[model samples]
Target: MSLAARTLELLRDEGVDRVFGNPGTTELPLLRELATTTDPSYVLALQEFSAVSAADGYARGTGRPAFVSVHAVPGVSNALIGMNNARRSRTPLVITAGQQDQRFLRDAPMLGGDLVGLAAPACLTAEEVHTGADLLPLLRRAFARVRRQPSGPAFLSIPMNLLAADEDVPVPSRIPAPDAGPSPAVEEAAAVLRSAERPAILAGDRVGATRSVAELTALAEALGATVYPQPQYEYVNADSEHPLTAPSPHFTGTEIAKALAGHDVLLVAGAAIRPHVWTPERPIPDGVRVVQLDDDPAEIGRSYDVEVGLAGSVGATLAALTALLPGREADRERGARIAETLLRERTTWRDRARAGVDAGGPLDPASAAQAVADAVAPGTVVVEEAPTTGPALRRALVQRDAGDYHNSSGNGGLGWGAGAAVGLALAHPDRPVVGFLGDGSAMFGVQGLWTAARLGAPVTYVVVDNGGYRAVSDALPPGFEGTRLGGVDWAGLARSLGLHGTAVEHGSEIGPTLAAAQRSGEPSLVVVRIRGGAS
Candidate 1:
């Protein structure tokens, strides 16, 4: 069998039924082979950035390693931004790039740069396959690493000549999943939780990635602890409507320290202690003791000092801690107090949001987000990239279920939402997918709309067209120039790209417009125009 055929067979064995890519000349051999294969379908993207972002979304949605293929040097370089996003999001992906024929290496042939070197910084494992015999083995290793703990993208550069060559290689029967049992530290962690007067759990993306929401809830209930998600990636960590759940505070260390001031013990699980984009002058609160549990030891105390760092599977560790803790019945009074506090905080936030919505004129981001949230179906998946209006959206549209919400990683890339929504719709064909994007963010990878329309994906794109980079304008000091973007007809652009388009200038039209797009059951876009002056 050809090396390409063997590689496809291994992918099939690993249950990868789709490949996302934008092919170039060096990728012809593999593309040709994929054209004839029936089991694993090929999903074509117009650009390499969309290709990688699509795979990232698919992996995050399905809890499996996604497969992606791209051309040589330029393709790898174009894919770096999305790959870095995947690494920061900890999405499992196996990204393979085609390299030029090995025979012409000394000649410095076209598209013959160091693919591994280019990919190494963004990948968990980066290597080049030199021969047909090495292809399957390298793929196996890549798949294994991508699916391992603290999962991220892996890279394999296969030369075009190698793919065209015929060599027999042994395909492994099965690759075992990584598992870490309970450790002794789990008991110590439980003791701290049991002794604390007020305890809190700061959850992260890994909790949802591992499908441990129930375990986390059980642990939280046992300890009568309040639960908060990591600030930047606030989705699927816990049920938003749960009595013990609290909205994730701002990412600034000083803000977080203030939010968590009253809590005596902070148990961080499946997330870093602190991931901040901008530094603050004030330090974290000094009184609280932090205990961290993660599958990756490197993440335990990387950001802040911790009292105890437990390295193990988050699900297993939580299960062990729950078993060691006393019954929830013993903490009934504490649970009641926590519930009352959470309700008060939630009420205050909602009142403030309502006031903001009422103060704005005809079209406002908060009102539009509420309308979209109301229009979407029960099982709809939401991908968000509207940074300036994201807080209002989150506050108005509460997500109660796991795997229902997705956002950009800590890297905060602009074009991630459109491509991710496309990939998500492809992954979950039975459910509707909606992308809430800023006008500036949508322009980053607008070509993804073409792919969605071509595939007839069940996706509704809602662009909050507040002119241009509103987030930038809001962040910079007054009198700062260069952030203004004049009117752009995003709906007309979508219509030209073969998607049904609707434009709305009033809050009342937002829900009906979205409802119409959802009823059409085709790729559609709703352009919502709002005031673009200060955030």
Candidate 2:
């Protein structure tokens, strides 16, 4: 069989049903083979960045590794930004780039460069298949590395001549991921939690990735502990409305220290102990014990000092800890007090949002977000990258499901949401997928709209057109300049890209526009023009 045929067979055996890519001359051999194969459908993007971002979202939505193919050096370089985003998000991806024919190596042909070197930094593993015989082995290794615990993107460079050559290569069987059993440190961590007067659980995106929300919730309730998400990677660890579940505190060190002031024990589960994007120089409260749990040993106590660091599966460790700890009834009083505080905070935020809605003139972000949240059907998936309006949207929408929300702020990467929505919509075809993007972010990967339209993806792209990079503007010191982004008609651009486009200037139009777009059963964009100033 040809190497391309064997590659497809191996991918199919590994449960890859689709391949996302933007093809070039070197990829023609693989593309020809893919056209004849029916199992793994080819989903094309106009650009390599969109291709990688789409795969990233698909992996996140499905809890499975995704495959992507691209042209050689330039293509891999173009996709590096998305690859970095995937690395930060810990999304598993198998990225393959087609290299120039091996025979032209001495000449260093056009479009021929060092593909492996370009992709290595952005991936967990990067290698090249030097011969047809090496292709299957390299692919097997790539798949294994990408699916390991603390999984990330892997890259493989396949020469075009090798892919086209006939070879009697044996199809490699898929390798199962290794699991780490419970360790003694788990018991020590449980002991710390049980003995502390006030314990708190800090969950992260890994909790959702591991499907360990139920176990984490059980452990938290067992200790009568308050649950907070890592500030940058907030999602539903417990039910969002649960009394013990609190919104993630601010990212600053001072704010986090304040929130954790009284907690005697901090059980950091399925997350790094201290992964801060930007933090003030404030120490955590003295005498506060930190116990960390993670599947990756490298991340245990990586950022902050820890009393107990356990390396094992998050779900299994939480289950064991819950079994060892006392029931929620044991600390009912402490739990009640924590619950009351969280309830008051939530109430205050909601009241403030209601006032904003009632006093609206030009559409405020909070009001616009609330309208969309109210209009979308239950179980709708939101892919958000609206940095300036994130807090407002989080307060207004208040997503409760563990899988209903995905944000691109993990790596602070713009332009991810547009393409991610395309892949997420494909992953969950039955549910509506909304891409809430800032106007500045929308411009970064606007080409993805063409792919959405081509695939007829069910996405309602809401471009929050604030006329500038509001997040950057808001962060700058008093009178800094050069952030203004004026005179771009996002709705018109969407229309030109073959999507249904609507321009909305008032909060009243947000709901109707979103509803109509969803009902249209095709790719659509709503350009929401807000009061244009620094956030």
The true-versus-predicted C-alpha distance at residue 356 of model 2, in Å, is 1.8
Clash-forming residue pairs, model 1: none
- Pick the lDDT winner: 2
User: What TM value does model 2 have?
Assistant: 0.95
Per-residue accuracy of model 1 over 227-342 as CA lDDT, tens digit each = 88777663578877788988777777777777788889998888754445565633246778888888888898887778888888888889999999966665767887888988
Q: Please give me the total number of clashing residue pairs in predicted model 1.
A: 0
- Put down candidate 2 lDDT per residue, 316-412, tens digits, no spaces: 8899998998785658778888889988987787666555654455567777677777778778898888777766777667566778888866576
What lDDT score is found at residue 205 in candidate 2?
A: 74
Candidate 2 segments whose C-alpha is farther than 4 A from its true place: 273-283, 328-330, 358-360, 477-481, 532-535
Query: Could you estimate the TM-score for every candidate?
Result: 0.95, 0.95
Residue 408 of candidate 2: its Cα lDDT? 64
Clash counts for all predictions: 0, 0
